[model samples]
Target: MELELKKLSPEDGRDVYDLLQALPADENGFMNPANGLSYDQYRDWLRFAAACLEQVGVVDGKVPETIFWLYEDGRPIGMGKVRHLMTEALLEKGGNIGYAILPSARGRGLGKKFLALLASESKQLHAGRLLLTIQNHNQPSIRVALANGGRIERVTADRHYIWIDP
Candidate 1:
């Protein structure tokens, strides 16, 4: 199984669109920003995402973010995002990284692998530590985070604040 982690590209095709569409708009605490977008709308969203990744500096208090896709043998299997910088809002709830494996790709240790790949990508962007905020009930995600060397930094009424080192 040849696996690769690739940055999001506006030029990404229908396969990418299909993958995003497979995820629900909200799952546990993870949000699928691309859900419900029409094909053309999805492409437009990609353009916006690409710009966010390429922006040199934070604008209007919004930090830059880069999304990545995990591919296995050239087929997309997972997707994630790394926020280049953290704001108080991010620290509180947004987090520095968020990810989701294709529902059909769950189990088989893919979530752990995906998280690790995102961390590597974060390191490349000079993003220090990664903060992951998982809903309290999402044990699968919590395990994935822990397997990747994440430590529980805090706990809220409904969330687990984990920090994964770069």
Candidate 2:
């Protein structure tokens, strides 16, 4: 399948909205601010997300983030995020990259490709080694990280801190 990575933008349509809806809620730390939003509200959230990339209106304690969509054959099937700078809290948990494949798209080797795509995106942002905080129980992600040259750097009660060369 043809694969492409695209930056998040206001021009995204219902596909992105549907993808966000399919993803877990932000309370789960998935960066899905558009969950449960009305279509118009989701549109607004798109602009807000762009503003976040510019460090224009990020909330206090939140780092500026760049969002990208992983598309297969021209349709979005996964999303990823890269925080511009690092923070202690981030290193301890959130890390530099966060990604999720559409539930329907899981187990198809897309997660590995998506992580690789995010790593390249991070390099473009001039980030050094990449950090990925994976849930302890998520074996697929743990494997994905490792496949992308990630090494287990630390282990917390509920998370595995991994580092991958960019």
Candidate 3:
């Protein structure tokens, strides 16, 4: 199947919201509470995403983040995020890229493809290398990272830190 990565847009709110509905609340670290918002709220979140790319908005000292969605035949299948610049906190735990394929779409090697696409996108931003952190128990995600040229940099109690040259 053909796959493409598209930057998130306000118009994509409904599709993203629907995709979120099909996923468990806490399945993917990439998704936060705001992502589960209804269409209206999600549209606001999209605006927040755009503002993040433009470096706007703040909440309790946190900044907004850029988000992208994976599409197949025009339907949303997964989502990913690229922090414009990594903060110290991100470097320690968040990493540079975060992504999640819908539950129904798992086990098809799509995660690797998704990360590959995100890596290309990160390179465009002039980032020398991308950092990705996967939970220790998420073997599938670890495989995906490895398949995309990611090398383990370190491992913490709950996560694996990987670096991929973009």
Candidate 4:
């Protein structure tokens, strides 16, 4: 399948949020079981996504940064976010990167490709190490991380944090 990655725009928020909302509920209306974000949290997350995209324009005075919105067959399919470096939570569990593939696009290799794209961008940022965390039971995510050279650092009930050293 052909997928294109584009810089996310504020107008993309509605579409992104709508897509996230349409995700298959895990008996709790959340895309991931490990994510305890309530409906409102999801809403806020969409807004945050938009803000992140806006920030990318001037991200530390660097224009044309590396945040991307994945499109499959010309339709929005996912979103990928890359932090310049690792944060405390990221170092511990969240990781320096995070990605979400549309529920309908899960089985495809989009997530892996997205990770590779982020990793390449992180490298440009002089990042020698990248972190990615996923829920232990999230086999697909785990597989994606592993496929992208992620080394299992540790596993927790809420997540399995992996380290990706470029």
Candidate 5:
């Protein structure tokens, strides 16, 4: 299936909520919400996500972030977050990009394609290089990063820091 990456928008609230609902709780730490949320709450969250692109709201003491939805034939199948600017704290942990494919859409190389799309977007934003960190056991993500020209820069106890030039 052909896939495309689209920035999150207000009109995508319902689709975004559905995508979130379709994800497993432990799929990706940042993409997972601890509890179920009503549509209204999810809409509010979407608003915040959109505002993050402008660095208007502060969440967890980070910079503004841009979120993108991966779509296949107009259907949301995955989501990714790109931090426009990286702070010291983010450099150490969060990295510049984060993404997760829906549970039903895994094992088809979508993850690699998602990161490649994010890399292109990052380049357009003037990001010289992108930082991606994945859990040590997340072989799938690691492979995705590596396949997208990501090099292992460092390794912490539970995370692997990969860098890719966009």
Candidate 6:
């Protein structure tokens, strides 16, 4: 159950997209709430991911501080991201961390392992706590968060925001 995390590359875009497409219907795909993404929605998501990379100035031999890929047994299974506080809106609403495990990879402890790995990495980035926002209905994510020392910070109308402090 050892999972490896690697920095994402543009070459990985296709595999990531494919994994997202094959995500199981019961678990959250790229756009949580499961039911998976429509063909048009998937295209739009790819466009948006590309735009975000461009906006971060991380294209062409640059490393992104936020977005990264999560791999298991050399296969792409999910993505994890941590946005710095440079953007005030992200600090407040989006929080500092977010992750999505492909539905096909769920129930294998990959998500929990990813969360723990990121929480440990947060210390190097001067982050005392890692923030996670899960849809209220995502029981699996909530369990994963709690298993990784996440404590409930607040429960909004539609989401539960938890904090995993080091």
Among all candidates shown, the one with the greatest TM-score: 1
TM-score for every candidate vs. truth? 0.96, 0.93, 0.88, 0.67, 0.90, 0.67
TM-score of 2: 0.93
Task: Give the lDDT ranking, best first.
Answer: 1, 2, 5, 3, 6, 4
**Tens digits of lDDT, candidate 4, 1-166:** 6777776554454565565555444421123321445556656655665565445333443332235667777777776666665545456655667677777777868888878877776776665787777776778878988998889888877778788876
The parts of candidate 4 lying over 4 Å away from their true place are: 11-17, 24-67
| Model 5 error, position 161 (Å) | 1.0
Better of 1 and 3 by TM-score: 1
Off by over 4 Å in 6: 23-65, 86-88
Q: List the residue pairs that clash in candidate 4.
A: 90-95
Q: Which portions of model 5 miss their true places by more than 4 Å?
A: 25-28, 33-35, 56-60
Give the per-residue lDDT of model 6 (tens digit) for 95-130.
Answer: 667677876677888888888877776676565667
The residue-by-residue lDDT of candidate 1 on 41-154, one tens digit each, is: 999999998999888777998899889999989999888889989988888887999999999989999899888888988888998989999889999999999999999989
Best-fitting candidate, scored by lDDT: 1
User: Candidate 5: lDDT of 106?
Assistant: 88
Q: For model 5, where is the 10-residue window of minimal lDDT?
A: 26-35
Error of 1 at 150 (Å): 0.8
Candidate 5 backbone collisions, by pair: none
* Candidate 2: stretches off by over 4 Å: 26-28, 56-59
Clashes of each: 0, 0, 0, 1, 0, 0
lDDT of 5 by residue, 11-128 (tens): 7767778888877656645556512778887777777767767765455786777888899878998878888777788787778998889878889988889998988998776657
In candidate 1, list every pair of residues with a backbone clash. none
Q: How accurate is candidate 5 locally (lDDT)?
A: 0.81
The number of residue pairs in model 1 that clash at the backbone is 0
